[model samples]
Target: MTKHMDLPEIIPIFPLPGALLLPRARLPLHLFEPRYLAMLDDALKTPERLIGMVQPNRMPGRNGGTGLHTIGCVGRVTQFSETEDGRYMITLTGLSRFRVVEEVEGFSPYRRAKVSWTGFERDKGPSETDDGFSRDKFMNLLSRYFTAQELQTDWESLKEADDELLINSLSMLLGFEPEDKQALLEAPSLSTRRETLVTLIEYSMRGGDGEDIMQ
Candidate 1:
C-alpha cells in the first residue's frame, strides 16, 4: 500500500471525459497530447508524482475554458515509461478521492487544484461490505449485456476473480456513459456501486446504447 504520510494539498488535474480512478483501483493512461505530456514531465520532477483524474463537464465557458466535475480521484504514478513514438505510457494507482475546494492559478500548461479530502478519507481504507454480493444475478445481467453488445469475454476467468477486482476492473473497462461512470465513481459505498453497475448493465441490454459507452 502507498504510504500517504503527507498528502499534498495541491495536485495537477487531468480532466478526461469517461475516465475515472477509484481508490485501490489502477488506471493506465496514454499521454500523447502536448499539454498532458507537459503535465507528465512536471509530475516526474515532483516527489509526490500525484495527479487528479477528473471528468470534464459537457459545457465549456465562453472563454473556451472547460468546466470540470467537482469531485475527482487522486492517483499516484506507480509505473511510467516513454515510447519511441514520443508518447508516455503510465499507470496511476488510485490513492484517494478529493473534492475541488478551489482551482489554483498556475504557470504550468495544465490545470491545478487545491483539493480537500474530508468526507472521502474513507477512500484510503478497504471497502466495507456485507459479503452478500449476488454473483449469479450480476453475471447473468453481464452476460445479457455482453451478448447485446456483441462482445466476448472469458467467463471462466471472470468468475474466478474476487468481488473487488471484478467490480473495479469491469467498471473501468466497460463503456458506461460519462454520467453513468461518474455515478459509479461517486457511489457512497461498494454495495451501492455494485447495484448501480448491475442496473447499468440491464439498461444497456435493454437498448440503452452500449456501443457508445467508452472503451
Candidate 2:
C-alpha cells in the first residue's frame, strides 16, 4: 500500500493523448520511443517506480511547444519486461491523480514536473463506493454506446466489477476523445465521473451535432 507520503513531489510525466489512468486501475504501455525508453530507465531507478500519465493539451504552450493538461494520474510500474528488440512492455498501477505545479527544467530527454497532491489525498486510500450509481441504467447506456461503436466486451465480467472499477475502466478503455477522457480524470468523485461518462456517450450517439438520435 502506498501512503500519501510515499508519493514524490517530482516525477516523470508521459504526455500521451487519449490514454487515461485512474486511481486503482492498471494501464499497460509499450515503450519504443527513445525518450520514453529513457524515461522508463530512470523511473526504474527510483524507489517508487512511478510515472505520471498526462494527456497533451490541444493548445500550444507559451514556448510554442505542446502543452500538457494540468491534471494527471501517477502510476507505479508493477510489471515490466524487456523485449528482444530492445522495446519495453510495462504495466502501471495507478496510485493517485495530481495537479501540476510547474514543469521542471531538467537534463533528461523526457519531461518532469513538480506536482501537488492536496485535493487528491483520498486517492491513496481505499477504493470509493458510489451510493448513487444505478447499475441497470448505466449498463443500458453502456450497451447502446458499445453497439454504436461496434465494441465487444464480456458483459458478465463488467457486471462482476465493483462500482469504481466499472466506471473507471470504461472511462479508460472507451474510445472517447482526449478532452473527454481528461474530463473524466478531473471528475471530483465517482458519481461525477459516472455522470460525465454517460453524457459523453450520449453526445457521441447524437453524432456530436445536437440531434435527437434516441428517437
Candidate 3:
C-alpha cells in the first residue's frame, strides 16, 4: 500500500542566496525587506501559508534579480507575527522538496515561481532503525570537524538525536561549501546525504579549504 501527500498550488517562494533549508529542520525568516513583506501578506490571505525556499546561484543580478537553483524545499508558515511598520516575523517548518517548473511572474516586487512539487515526497522523518555504523561514522567526522572549527556543541543531544534531526543539525553546523550544501539539499536519500556530508567534513578537516569534498 502507498499514500500520497496533499500538495497545495499557488505556493509562494522566497529565493535566497547561500540559504539551504533541509527537511525536518526549522527555518526562521525575518521579513523586513519590502518585497518579502508583501509576500508574507499574500501568504497570510491564503489557506496554505506555504512557501518554497530556494537559493540563488550568485548575487542578485545587476538588475537586483538572481538565478535560482533548480531544487528547493517547500516550508509551511507555522508561526507569524507582524510589526507596526509592516515587517513580518515568521518560522517556516520544512515540508517537502520541489523542482521549479518555471518562474511565475508576480505583481509584487519580489519574484515568484510556478513550482512543480507533485513528484516530491517528504520523508517520514526517520525511524529508530535508521541508526548504525554509517550514521556514527558520519557523526564522528562531524565531531572532529567541530573541534577543528573551534565550535562548542552538545554531544549528548547529538548522539541521542534521531536520524532526521542529526542530519539537519549537522547540515546547519558543518562548514559546507555553498555548492556542496546545495548538493546535500538536492540529495534524494538520507543515507546518501549522510555520506555526502561525511565526505565534505572529512575534506574540510583535512584543510579547511573551499574545495569540492564529495567524491
lDDT of 1 at 23: 87
lDDT of 3 by residue, 1-215 (tens): 01234656556778876567876677888899988887788877876676788877664552234377778887778898888997888988776788776776757777777667665554424332244446556666666677778899888998898786787767755666678888888877777777677777777766757665333
What's the candidate order when arranged by decreasing TM-score?
Answer: 2, 1, 3
Candidate 2, residue 17: Cα displacement in angstroms equals 0.6
Q: What's the candidate order when arranged by decreasing lDDT? A: 2, 1, 3
Output the lDDT of residue 24, model 2.
93
- Estimate the TM-score of every prediction: 0.89, 0.93, 0.82
Q: Which portions of model 2 show Cα errors greater than 4 Å?
A: 61-66, 209-215
Which is the better candidate, 1 or 2, if ranked by lDDT? Answer: 2
Span of ten consecutive residues with least summed lDDT in model 1: 206-215
Local distance difference test, each candidate: 0.83, 0.90, 0.71
Question: Model 3, which residues run further than 4 Å from truth?
Answer: 1-5, 59-66, 83-86, 122-133, 208-215
Candidate 2 lDDT? 0.90
* Per-structure clash totals for the candidates: 1, 0, 1
lDDT of 2 by residue, 16-43 (tens): 9999999999999999999999999999
Tens-digit lDDT track of model 1 for 1-215: 46454678999999999997998889999999999999988888988888999988776662135487778899989999999999999999998888887788978889998888889877888755527788887787788778888999999989998787788778888999998888888988877888788778877765655453322
**lDDT of candidate model 3 versus the reference:** 0.71
